[model samples]
Target: MKKFYYTLLALFFMLPACTKTDIVPFTPETDNQLLEYKIVNVQGSPIYGAINQQDSSITVYLPFYLQLITLEPEMKVSDGATVTPVSGTMIEDLLDLFHKGREIKYNVKGKDGKVKTYTLHVQVQQPDLILQEVSTDADNPNTYSLNMNLDFDSFSFGLDGAGFAADLDMIRVMLVDEQNKEYGPLNISTFNTTDLTRLDFTVIRYKEQSDPILAMLPAEGLYRIRVYSYAKVATTKNPIRINLLNKK
Candidate 1:
């Protein structure tokens, strides 16, 4: 019995020592907190939105971006961070677009991370614009001037998104006849993609060199404007603007 008691006491003392073992210090990994990223346009199109700034810097188009992260405590970017607005852009215009997109994220660095960015959908809001047929020559209703109604001090994107350094080759304009036949590739003379609710698009009258006189077409016929924007592959939405005067 005495021998057993001594052994038990020795084991008890050992247990206490085992419980107080020293631990090694931990070190966090040092690397750019990035998993994967993507850039897209407002039409929910995938693209590598970028711009070559003549000056070492330029604002580029990023209709939207997403990040796939493995950790949560690790942040990527913050919300409402001052992003380099797309080059040739206005803060007010960008803000309006961001607001319309409803999902905006800041490109952050280090612990100031935003989150496991799901999908911050930015959109190219139709600039608040309206197209009107104002005739300088009252004698000829066919001769009219296309006027633009714009309300902005600063904005981004251009008419038809051209000259803004975007992929314009993918955009086009079309004109459909009464039989729905097409005739175009016409230059978008006056139109805008700025963030607006309404905009004056273009003025068209019978031009011998350009458009055939309305009287030449079927006196009793119909027509439509087809806008095939580059966004979808198998499916495309047609925003048809018609001749309100001719339509019954």
Candidate 2:
């Protein structure tokens, strides 16, 4: 009985040491913080609603020649959290108007007292080229012909695009043969300057003996006319191509 009583006393003394210590639980954020960002107003035909959000950053591609660089954005953030540079806020113009993009920071404070900063990138994109019309000197309505043996004249076309022509650093015109040979930064003239939405340009073939435009191409083969757009800041997208054939 004495030994049993001593064993009970030892067990009681060890109970406190066996107790588990209290610890704080770990938490991972899974809330949908940003819902949407929409462009509200703009001038003359600038593209909008191009907001792409990844994680905590948002990107907006604006037209290159957009004169009024200001914009009002509508944003939707998580519930119980407030954001700065609030929705419908008219952001000021870009710092380096013609050469650089703008950045806006949005601060969000959640209900848990945590603050996060999201970056908004406003960038410009290179204009896209489109062939609105093409014409050749071929008399036959059914077939087109190119007589490189002649003075290399009588070809013209109209060009337009999804962006402004003023945004382009330069437009390169090339003729690609089936064998992948490219020829001519063909001289072209524009009809107007201010409104570049639609440009009517006429292709002028050089008559120089040493020029590639004077070289005699295949009499009967497939050829392509490519127009490339180079922007001042943005990456140039794919060039526009127009296919033609000479059935000589």
Candidate 3:
């Protein structure tokens, strides 16, 4: 009876070892897409590209002054995927490609050996205002003058580009003294309507009700004028040096 009980316990323990469990097979990843793209470390601001998965293309709008050849793109791809000309590579031939109206191309491959190509289209944004020239008024010692090219249609619509009447208030004029002391939200004298392309205007000395001396233009100091709209700005290319002891 003791031997029979020991044999039954051994058989119970061995039964579990003999049973089998299902094994899961490995599956290769098929995801191969460029998930995100951006141009970073540019002159002013970082630019993000709009990605269109359906068309497998990306579009980026850059400031007109930004050189395309200097672009180093950062990209993110799907897991288990690799992209050619890897991220953070400067696109040397970008300007030449743009001049020929050709798009920059990138290739991505997945672990399953499948590949997809994506094209990048770059465009330059049009300026709302262009500064042409700036100078000091010889006739009026305290007055500063400048010329600019205005996109009347763009200025009329405002910065958001969604309005009927012209938002003339969007344009501003300012004066900066040698010490970097800034003055004015000065008033523009008037516009020369004869040639809209060559819009001419003048800015007289700024006035303040509280401080008369501060209101008057300094008799002797280096100064410059700044003209700007929402989209662009123009300043004296060279500083205007002044040394008029008799003038107020």
Best by TM-score: 3
List the candidate numbers ranked by TM-score, top first: 3, 2, 1
Compute the lDDT of residue 15 as modeled in candidate 1.
85
For residue 172, what is the lDDT in candidate 3? 57
Cα displacement (angstroms), candidate 3, residue 102, comes to 3.2
Clashing pairs in 2: none
TM-score each candidate: 0.23, 0.37, 0.39
lDDT of 2: 0.55
Candidate 3 local Cα displacement, residue 167, angstroms: 29
- Candidate 1 ranges with C-alpha deviation above 4 Å: 1-169, 185-193, 196-200, 203-220, 233-248
Instruction: Give candidate 3's TM-score.
Output: 0.39
User: Which ranges of candidate 3 are over 4 A from the true structure?
Assistant: 1-30, 43-45, 127-248
lDDT, candidate 1, 1-248, per-residue tens? 99999999999888867656689898854232323233322335543322221221212333212211111111222323323222222233333343233433333233444322122333332222222222223333232222112211111111221112123333344445646666554454334444322223343443333333322333232334444433211111222323323312
lDDT of 2 at 4: 100
Which of candidates 1 and 2 reaches a greater lDDT? 2
Best by lDDT: 3
Per-residue lDDT of 209 in model 1: 35
Q: Give the Cα lDDT of each candidate.
A: 0.32, 0.55, 0.58
Name the lDDT value of residue 231 in candidate 3: 36
